[model samples]
Target: MATTSLVPSSADDPLAYRPIALVDLLDRVLGTGVVVTGDITISIADVDLVYLSLRALISSVGALTPPEPPGGAG
Candidate 1:
């Protein structure tokens, strides 16, 4: 008795397809990927906290003066 082959040897077969690389897959996913559009709503609390933190950080950083010129005041 002889066993029969389940899959035929052919390049067109589904199993013969080449595997995709992770980098290529990610590139396609991250670049020119799907675009989803919808309405988004956020509570005032979240927005207020983010804005306040950014304002404080910006103001503090802006207050810092540059070091004195190498030639003593430009």
Candidate 2:
């Protein structure tokens, strides 16, 4: 994210992320990349909608995890 700094892990360890905030990761990915716009052979107006919906769905459901706990000794 442009406004957020990367959180680092232990010194002896490799750069590990603690499951980066979904919004933050997306922001950084989008912001850092070069955005190029040109005349598309295919209709961009239609393609653009697919891109937008996919991004929205990813942000909404990507980071969530299941709440189940391990079952073993009782």
Candidate whose lDDT is highest:
1
Instruction: Give the lowest summed-lDDT range of ten residues in model 2.
Output: 51-60
Error of 2 at 59 (Å): 16
Per-residue lDDT tens digits of candidate 2, residues 1-74? 36644566556457665577988877765544433344434346565433221122232222344445678434
Clashing pairs in 2: none
* lDDT (Cα) of model 1: 0.51
How well does candidate 2 match the true structure in TM-score terms? Answer: 0.28
* Model 1 alpha-carbon miss at residue 53, Å: 37
What lDDT score goes with residue 14 in model 2?
A: 77
Quantify all predictions' global Cα lDDT against the true fold: 0.51, 0.49
lDDT of 2 at 12: 43
Q: Which regions in candidate 1 have their CA more than 4 angstroms from the true location? A: 1-16, 35-74
Query: What would the per-residue lDDT of candidate 1 be over residues 5-64, giving only the tens digit for each residue?
Result: 765555557666466999886666555444444444545856633222121122222235
